[model samples]
Target: MKAVHFGAGNIGRGFVGLLLHEAGCEVVFSDVAESLVQQLQQADSFTVTTVGQHPTTTVVEGFRALNSDQDPETLTEEIASADIVTTAVGARILRFVAPSIAAGIAARPAGAPPLAVMACENAINATDLLEQEIRANYQGEDLEEKALFANTAVDRIVPVQAEGAGLDVTVEDFFEWAVERGPFGGNEPDVPGITWVDDLAPYIERKLFTVNTGHATTAWHGWAAGHATIAEAIRDPAVAIEVETVLAETSSLLSARHGFSEDDMASYRAKVLGRFANTALPDPVERVGRGPLRKLSREDRIIGPAAALAERGLEHEGLLSAVAAALAFTPEGDEEVDRLQDLLRTTSADAATLEITGLAPDHPLHPEVRALIAARITGP
Candidate 1:
């Protein structure tokens, strides 16, 4: 078996690529980073260190690397004959990689088995977004026959690597890669890391609302409390209180909308918080809380659950508080933070709320979000 995995970053190498290598697939990493590609091409093997309760190191080998930007034809050819194609690229970059995948699909043999394509991104239904872009680029009518796109929910905490850690990755031990089973027709990929599910919506929302939402809440609130790392921030009593409140609100929404049991959500929430408190990870607040504008969008981690809860007349004050904290996240270097600060300074409260969160004037959450921005602008 062979797999073409995009991104080649920490998540890609540590999680997805490692799993693929274990599955007996020759993993070809397609990346645009020239240095990273060269390093992979030169190295015989790399190590993935899983930290936390059961710390262990595994060496992965028998992989190839390609510079997608420098050698599109070779990358396309590799994708053409691969059994699986996966991506850890952010949801926004899916479009840029779509054309290459489309070209590869077009080059496949007539009777070839459909290539299983999954985007292991933090966003909800990220593979659906990739499929849409692939469809636009594909000229042939048998797109479905050539490729299978499965939406996935991937959860793992891959912290920033220490300097000089070449292709090595340090990630938390706890991880989950849940993929939809509908696309595979009972013949899923031979990846032991995947948990095939009938309906991926619940898993997606559960991870997004709980993990993504809670992580962002911790980061934003941690930044507000003048903390650096997630471990330090989550350990702070005040930040922990705010984080728990936000999780409680999102937990209620998850149970109400997804039929997840209260007990189950409570256990999951506890486990997630424990993961955040893992001092071994040492994730920085600004790293997790970067891209504040994107995180604050209506369909994203913060606003998505909050908007749903508000529309249902449920408690969303905790989430709104997180929103306010996110707005105050002005870490230096993040373009989104700079943009957000500028947007708040230059635009009206109502306009900034709409532009930032994509909430219309009549949205149930609009007035509250507008009020938050208004307070930020004019002072509490």
Candidate 2:
């Protein structure tokens, strides 16, 4: 089998690409980074270490580079021949990668193999956005029927490699890749390499609420408590207390929404907590909390799933505090920091809160979210 994956970054080589090779597929990674592309071609393979006391190396092999810009035709051929295609390119660059994908679609000849384009991004409805971009390039039947996309949820804490930009990456062994149909408003399942289920909502919420929420909790509390890393942050009593509180709130939401039993939820939380405490990761506060604007978007991080759950009559105040902390995420010179700071400065706290959070002006939670932001700015 052959697979074509976008983004030759850590996620491409360390997570997905590594797994694909282990599953016996010859993988070709298409990337926009010129240096990264050269690195992959030169290395031919790289290693990913499990984040634990006994750090183990997982070798990812057989994948080479196909530059989308310099080798569009080469990229096109790979996609056309691919049994399945997957992407780990960051969400913001989806539009930039569309044309290369469109060219790939154009290159397919008669009896082309079935193709599935799964965007392994962190967005709530990532595949929805990715499919939209891919479809925008097609016309008529090709747009409607030529291909398929399966919305998926992926969770693996692969932090930015500290080894200074080679194919090598460090990641936690715990991973979740869940696929969905129907609510994606589509018919028929497409391709392989995913765990397709009828409802993606439950799975997505579970991961976002539990995993993403915990990671962010570590980041925010970690930063405020003066810890340089996630591992260190969890050691602080205040940070741990806050993270536990946030997880409880998230658990309530998940249990209400998914019918997950309390015992099961506890086990899940324990496992996640275990993952966060991973020593090999020692994830920096900056890495997890890097992009304030993106994480605070309507469809990402704590706010997105939290608000959605709240509308469904689930607990959200703890999440509201998280959103507030995200706003207080004042890392010097980070563009979103300036943007959020400006919003708070130029507008009323309530209005700035409403605008960034996508909350209704008169929404009951608006008051709570605003109060939380006020507390974060002034402290405890």
Candidate 3:
């Protein structure tokens, strides 16, 4: 079996690529970074270090890399013949990869076996969105017959590796990729470590609201509190309380929305906090909280649940507090932070809230965001 995986970054290699290799598939990495492509081409394999509890090392071999921009034709060929295709590119980069995927599908031999295309992004329904973009370019092709696009929710804490680690990805051992299997027509991909579900909503919301929400809350609060790393901040009693409080709000929403047992959700919350406190991972607060604008968007972690809860008249003050902390984050190196800061600095909080979160001015939660922004700027 062969897999064509996009994004040669840490999560791409450490989590997705490693699992694909272990599933007995030869992996072909497609990346736009020339330097990374050259590095992968030079080295036949790379190391994935699993941190936390029992630390272990796994060497991923029999893989190749192609520069998606410099060599699109070759990448298209690989994708055309791939047994499975997966993407770990950030949600924003989904469209850029779509054209290549479309060309691959267009060039594929008629009546060829179905190709499984799953996007392992952090966002909800990511592969569905990817397929939508691909269809825009590969019109007239019956994608349902040619490929299976599976929406997936991936959860893993692959921190920024130590500088000069040289292709060795350091990641936490805990990971999950819940995929929607209804579109597979009973011939799901043979990849291991994937939990296939008929309805992915419960799993997606569970992971998103718990893992992602908790991580972002810790990052934003931790950054505002001057803690540099997730482990350090999670260790602090105050930051930990904020994280738990936010998780409690999200848990309520998830339980009400998905019928999850309160006990199970509580267990999940505890496990997530333990993952954050994994000293071996050591994720920087700024890196985790880099994209403040996207994080605050209506469909994203913070405002998504908060807005939903507000509609149901449920408690969401914890989420609002985390949103305030995220607004205060202006990490030095992140370009998006500067953009977000400028927007808030120049415009009224209400205007910025509308533009950033995609919330209507008349939204029930709009006033809440405005109030939080005011509180955040004024302090206490």
Which candidate's lDDT is highest? Answer: 1
Looking at model 1, the pairs that clash are none
Candidate 3: tens digits of C-alpha lDDT, residues 272-300? 99999998888999888878887888888
User: What is the total number of backbone clashes in candidate 1?
Assistant: 0
Score every model by TM-score: 0.97, 0.88, 0.97
1-380 per-residue lDDT for model 1 (tens digits): 99999999989999999999999999999999999999999999999999987899999999999999999999889989999999998887899999999999999998999999999998888999999999999979999898999999999999888899999999999989999999999999999989999999999999999999989999999998899999999999999999899899999999998898989999999999999999988899998998898899878999999999999999998899999999898889999999899888888887888899999999889999999999887422
Ordered list by TM-score, greatest first: 1, 3, 2
**Residue 359 deviation, candidate 2, in Å?**
1.8
State model 2's lDDT: 0.75
Please give, for residues 1-380, the per-residue lDDT of candidate 2 as tens digits: 78888987767877778777777888899997888888888885688877665668877777778779899888988887776678898787787887777667766775664466778887777877877887787644564344667787888888878866467888887777788765435543333445668888888888887888888878976887788888888878888887888888878777876899899989999998888887767688888887776777666767766776667777666676677667767777577777777776677666666667776766556667767655544311
Clash numbers, per candidate:
0, 0, 0
Off by over 4 Å in 2: 53-55, 181-194, 312-315, 346-351, 371-380
Where in model 3 is the C-alpha error above 4 Å? 374-380
lDDT (0 to 1) per candidate? 0.92, 0.75, 0.88
Candidate order by decreasing lDDT: 1, 3, 2
